[model samples]
Target: MRKPWCSTSSLALALVTVIVVGLAGAANAQGAAPAPAGPPPPAPTADEIKKVTEYYLRGKDVGPILMELVVCKKMGKSAENKSICEEKHGDTLKKGDPLIAFTRFFVPKGAKYEDLKVKFLLNGEVRSTSDFTLQESWTGYGNYKQTTASKPGTWEILVLRGETQLATAKVTVVE
Candidate 1:
């Protein structure tokens, strides 16, 4: 009989070439090559990221809402749990008068109970800061108690969520 058109070794070599090409094409079609085998990355450490002081509403980019911010002579809540402001005064506040900075706000849906901040500033200087839990209807208040050391000048109240300033109210304080 005539010798086979291809030797056994050549057939084997041809078969190996076909398999390598097929595997390469399949890999390309699937995706990139597999990652090199190695030890897993080190676990993250707590100090890697700084603690976040500001928080977003409902994990969304939206911020909280401040409906009304008033600086009044007196502030209290009614028996029905509604806010009451007496002698609403923003034009000028008498030094040593019972001064109150009250704010009514609406926390975004799913953001209620989250922590917010109210800052009391006197002539652009932070006098005090208070934290309040966002309520469904209204929340926030800061008492600008006029102490002997309390300076008489422009007083401001600011509502903030994290680094975002939501609202601000200004009142002039007089001696």
Candidate 2:
């Protein structure tokens, strides 16, 4: 017969201990406890977009920003041929120039975001609307831009996510 030390209760206790130790080991294998969770930051508004672009991109004095139009720019084509500001900044684009838009920017954590709602404003009027979705990359920054013929004036480009503006720039289009 079996010994008293190998009773049913003893086996059950041993099994539980093994299970507990295995679970603890698994948890340890995983990294440390994640940071406290909370609601994400509210997307900045058009007004907020202006402020941020001004602070980081532009100085206290909001001066006119020239659009960096480009020729070999791909609005968003093949996977390998997608346009990026870091790659293609701007080209020569004149007034009444169809599909003449210099599209690209350096997003802080662009990959974490969605397609940004973009608007091209002239002098203060809305010229065109474009939405940008950040493509995957080695860096968090991504690029997406829209091209449309513009009139001769100051083209205020506002990059937005919803009503909140993410970035801003000004481009002078001449005739």
Candidate 3:
């Protein structure tokens, strides 16, 4: 005959195993919680784009200007054989992310603290602007290592030197 204590111990073990298996099954049925939805898409209307583009093109306050985008590494230098300022500034820029280092440039050689005016444009609309004295400079060129939050889309940057507007660079920032 089996010992009474042995039978009790075996029963307890089986009960525990069943409970664990049941809990595991329940957990598997639940699975992981569904991931939260992301933010809504940002799409500009055709009219809006036209209006913004017209504003930049028609603005007479600043003289004729040409803009370009430049992309580089974190060392504040242009990457090898990479266009410093052209259609695209950086390889990638996320929505609401800060400005990437070594991804921007301007003309007019060294911009004086009082003779510089910089503006950021999203889809041709002005999003932000800063003067030369307001922010620190990167070498003789404008600073690019500073962090500044920006919306994702076709972006353009305008740099003005005194009364003469220097250059503007456009880039696409993906979401």
**Best lDDT goes to which candidate?**
1
Candidate 3 error regions (>4 Å): 1-91, 100-113, 133-142, 145-149
The deviation in Å at residue 111 for candidate 2 is 7.5
Clashes of 1: 1
Worst lDDT window (10 residues) for model 2?
A: 60-69
What ranking emerges by lDDT with the best candidate at the front? 1, 2, 3
lDDT of 3 by residue, 56-139 (tens): 334334322233334422332334222232222365666765553232232221222455566777788877766644211111
Clashing residue pairs for model 1: 54-162
Error of 3 at 152 (Å): 2.4
- Total residue pair clashes for candidate 2: 10
Model 2 vs truth, CA RMSD: 17.7
Cα-based lDDT at residue 11, candidate 1: 84
Root mean square deviation (Cα) for candidate 3: 25.4
How close to the true structure is residue 96 of candidate 3, measured as C-alpha lDDT?
A: 64
Residue 69 error for model 1, in Å? 0.9
